[model samples]
Target: MEILIPLTASLVLLLIGYFIGTILEKKHYQSINDREEKFINLPSVTMTYRAASKETDMSKYSKTQLVSGGVVVSIDYFKRFLALLRNFFGGRVSSYETLVDRARREAILRMKEQSSGADMIINVRLETSTISSSAGDSETVDSIEAFAYGTALYK
Candidate 1:
């Protein structure tokens, strides 16, 4: 009887977290999709642009600037619990996958927004890191951050 109330309470909290997280994630994904479509025409140039930037005809471009974007996304408590279980069983942690995907995509979108009028973005790169808290002897994962950076050329 004593364990029943606590167990039921924990289950309720987990369900609440899951539903809220799902809704929020869906909204964010929709936003990402829309923004991606909005910037679909923007070309992400590679090393070729890097070489072009150094050409003698630099006057062709009105501006060349560096653009970057980064965001930190946190997982809901329910996801944390699932990740813990996955760790115990030793398999792929799928929840973390979405967290990372969301972060990376959001970062790229933001970078694109920064270079809205640029003809092309060149030498793009992405980096990710885990945000965690360490107090005394305990460490806990809090969030993950994704950063995107590139050079933009305005013509």
Candidate 2:
């Protein structure tokens, strides 16, 4: 009888813990989604303008070029950070999904901004780099760069 009582109590506590954990996880996901959506909505610029030349004029098409620029406004290392923390806690990395999603969104935004004004941006190349980072045992940084290029057209 004594053992049964203790086991029942333990089970109840475990259930409570599970419920709380789930609630917290849901909240976290919601917050992340909101934040990511906001960032995605930030005003962005589109650069470069290009147009294809006549098929007969290979030289013009070959010489056609447009310059597009995009700034790496944000570099979030927190995603990797959360993953590391989860590893330390011996838990699956459910928390890093947000980070991954954010990175992809940011990349697309940067590239889109760079190619925004181009008549038809083609042969786009995206480059990601870490421009600078604070030196510290506990400091980490992640950055992304995007480059878009296309032929310019003017009537």
Candidate 3:
């Protein structure tokens, strides 16, 4: 039947997309982990506005600067399909969770990389936004941007 051919083709395309997406996701995660490890000893990063009294004497540092990092990540077709289904059912869209998480982590890692010589990073902040792309006649959320920023102190 005509329907059978189109249906089969759609399913095959979906399967291919899913497999390729999964592989790319795994590779990205691995890269993130490796970068994180490389920066593990660079500096202490924190979200608190002020350093603890006992930690250090701020007057000694003599310099402070702002540092930031940002990353944009796109959602794969498979994840978009799952998210659409979840929207109709009114449940948690777990499929997008990893995408957001990865973006956040990557942004922070990049920030750390930028301030490799700093003694510490304080008042860390993160921001996220969705990017839309036009497909055919409609616009859809195609990617997310995560930004991380903080103050870096130097001796």
Candidate 4:
């Protein structure tokens, strides 16, 4: 009976986490899509500086400023449990993949938002970070972060 009580509690927590996490993730993706549409016209190049402004002359750019954006995304307990199972079975954990994707897109949107007035963004770059909780020899992923940066030019 004692073990049954703890097991039932854990199952309840897992269900709550799964439902809430799904709702929040969907909402976040919707917001990302909306913002992406708003900034679709702004050009952000990930290549070198020359490639970005190759056609346009440097004189056309009157000012240059560095812009950056970062976002952190945490996983739900249910997803964590899924990941553990996948680790044991040795297969893809696509549930975790969405978290990283969301963070990357959100970071880019934030960078673009910062440069809304600029003509273009050049030399864009993205960096990712992973946070984990390590207790003794066991390590579990807690969250992930994505950061985007670029140079914005204004005429």
Maximum-TM-score candidate: 4
Give the runs in model 1 whose Cα sits over 4 Å from its true position. 51-59, 136-141
lDDT of 1 by residue, 28-87 (tens): 999999999999999765555648658536578888899999999999879988998999
Better candidate number, 2 or 4, judged by lDDT: 4
Task: List per-prediction Cα lDDT, in the order shown.
Answer: 0.88, 0.46, 0.85, 0.90
lDDT of 3 by residue, 1-155 (tens): 88799888868877887899899999999999999898887664565645543576778787888999999999788788889889899878998999999999999999998887898888788999988866654637679999999998888
Instruction: Tell me which residue pairs clash in candidate 4.
Output: none
TM-scores for every predicted model: 0.89, 0.38, 0.88, 0.92
Q: Total clashes, candidate 2?
A: 4
lDDT score for residue 139 of model 2: 51
Over the stretch 75-123, how does candidate 4's per-residue lDDT look in tens digits? 8989988888898998889889999999999999999999879988988
Clashes within 3 Å, all models in order: 0, 4, 0, 0
Q: What is candidate 1's local distance difference test score?
A: 0.88
Clashing pairs in 2: 49-118, 50-151, 50-152, 51-151
Judged by TM-score relative to the true structure, which candidate is superior, 2 or 4?
A: 4
lDDT string, candidate 2, 1-155, tens digits: 78899888856665664566456546655754665564454333333222223222334333334544454433233344455677888866765444344444445444445444333334444454444467754754544444333333322
Please give the range of 10 consecutive residues that has the lowest summed lDDT in model 3.
44-53
